[model samples]
Target: MNYVSKMLGAPDISVTLARAAARRVYGHSNRTNPRAVPTSHRYRVEEVPPALPRALFDTHFAPLTERLPSVTYEMQRYLRRAASLRLAELISGGTWRQCATALAIPENSARQTLNVLGRAFAPDSLWPIFENVVDHIAQELDESDARVDYVKRRRLMAQWHLPADHHYAMCQDLRKLRTLREQSNPSPIEVLVWSAVTEAEYLHSPILRALRLSAEGGGRSLTLSIHRLVRPTSPVGGSLRLRPTD
Candidate 1:
């Protein structure tokens, strides 16, 4: 009654014989049993395997689908920031002017605060791509007066020492100095000292006032200069000279 029984032309087919026949037909084995063959020589219908459950299907695919979009978005953002930094470095290093003429921007206009910022924050891991973005910003600034002027104004104000009323400006400049200090290759102390001086000049706060007071008080007076300390004279001709004890 079963497919295997019909194939063997027998009233019943042994499970072992059916399994062996299936294996041979599927190419797992080459040898066949001649005695097990049926004279009818016709194939019978085989039962289809049961389908996998929905829960198992979801378990296998859900995680991959959930993570794919997040991974793609992060990679795209990383690439963009990387490219921006690369272009910035090129412009900051003074190479942008040469290339700007072809792009119809004045050399002066090509320099912008954004390009400087890009160069300053160039991503260490993605330096090359970021440099390209800096270059693009430079090129764009070259062609547009509005962008160039805005960048120039920002840079000028960034470095300018506005009076203490502009506490915000001083804060911005100090923040930039701190950022630069972290990135500079020089000794950290030296960078810090420079930053302090820059901050003092820009902010004119109590710290700078104290520093000025200390410098002015360091023994410089409005009278004839007098040596406050004495040193023993070096021995000459084997005789040490002594000051007269008047």
Candidate 2:
């Protein structure tokens, strides 16, 4: 019985010594080699501005009042003619490269022109008349595949580069224009016609002014007269006739 108790006590003593030695070694190692400790992150709190009134917010950011400046009509007509010419060039020639050369424009310029036309004559707008021109050109060409490919490529390019928010802003502007026109009690047709006219003027006024300035600076006098006639009663109604005189 005494020998068994001594054996048990010996094993316990060995375990206690082993634990003590391990503790000493660990403590010594920690003292000699301190590890890097991560610092706690600090955050800053900022005060936000007070919310603006809903009406004021809408007026400033998403205004529902769009007025067409007087020049848009002439600009629209010019753009339409230019669009038609571009489409004709694209369809008559097999390749845009040849068309660009014939038109004395760079390939990139031609592509940009087409992109602008596409946006201007969007399907949802009151420009379906121009769509027929595109359809005619597409049909006249034996290369339907080419037309489809061009559309796909153009769409991809637009998606990749065009600002998505600008379109939304334009839509908001249109809504505002409609609201303003309705409140004014003017016929929407007249408003649209006037808007189109103003759009042209807006585009051309700067050019015209620059031209006049150049003439003045060069010691040459210039006289310019523009007459615009709207024939709402003609067989082809709602047509704007522009005559420029020197």
Candidate 3:
């Protein structure tokens, strides 16, 4: 300090500071100190926020939910709200998990998500199909002379991934009421056989059959369905078993 005071007249000043002043006088102090933090550290690392895939959102998630616009729109709003909440939760910095958590969506759980999506993406409600079948099926068949169109039914059901099995079975029971009324001579106790022999022909079986492949493959493959806009039907035929191709 005494030597620096004598040299630069700045008593008790650091040698580096004294040198810095000398360099500044000649415009040479603009260079950073080697011992100091690097320029990289001065600039914070900025991360791009996680984005929901547009293709997946448009094709798989969006189109499937078109049938239930109100429900799906509400859900999307909730998810977006969840994402906003997660952003609020970030204290220091955000991570990928934080990003995913914000949207109330999981990451790297493809199989589970796809399975749920398969069920959630159902365009037609199985219960309604059953109800329709029960109410108008007899009339459509007997009075209206309309047979259960298996091709059209399969096409309709193929659009969904999951079939409401319990509900479909219940609808079958409702249909059997017609048969029960027509027994030739009612036995004291006759075993009521509710189409156990034709389990494949249930109302929702065709859709479940096609979607089994989708459910098994998880998120990798999407179900391929051909649909006609005909009114709902009392579906015929059994579970279709086919492998999705490459």
Q: In lDDT terms, which candidate is top?
A: 2
lDDT by residue (tens digit), candidate 2, 1-246: 333334323424453342223222211211211111111212100100011112222233211112222325333343433433334333342233344443323445445444544444333332333333433433433343322232232223322321335434433535533343344322222322322322222112222334446745421111111221231333121122221200
Task: Kindly report which residue stretches of model 1 are placed more than 4 angstroms away from their true locations once superposed.
Answer: 1-124, 148-246
* Distance from true location, Cα of 233 in model 3, Å: 40
Residue 148 deviation, candidate 2, in Å?
32
Worst 10 residues of 3 by lDDT: 237-246
- Superposed model 3: Cα runs more than 4 Å off: 1-49, 53-64, 69-74, 77-108, 123-246
lDDT of each: 0.29, 0.30, 0.27
Alpha-carbon TM-score of each model against the true structure: 0.19, 0.23, 0.15
lDDT of 3 at 122: 41
Candidate 3 local lDDT, 1-246, one digit each (tens): 334324544345553454344322211122211111112211111121122222223433333245554544335433222222222223223332343443323433222322333243344432223222222322222343322333333344343332245334433644432232233112101111111111111211333333455646421111112110011133232111111100
lDDT of 1 by residue, 1-246 (tens): 245334643436663464444322221112221122222211110100011112322343233224333433223322332222223323332233432332222344334422432333333222223333334444543454432222233233334343433433333534533343344322122322222332211112222323346746422321101111111244332112211110
> CA RMSD for every model?
34.1, 31.3, 26.5
Task: Please say which candidate is ahead in lDDT: 1 or 2.
Answer: 2
Candidate 2, residue 228: how far the Cα is off, in Å: 17
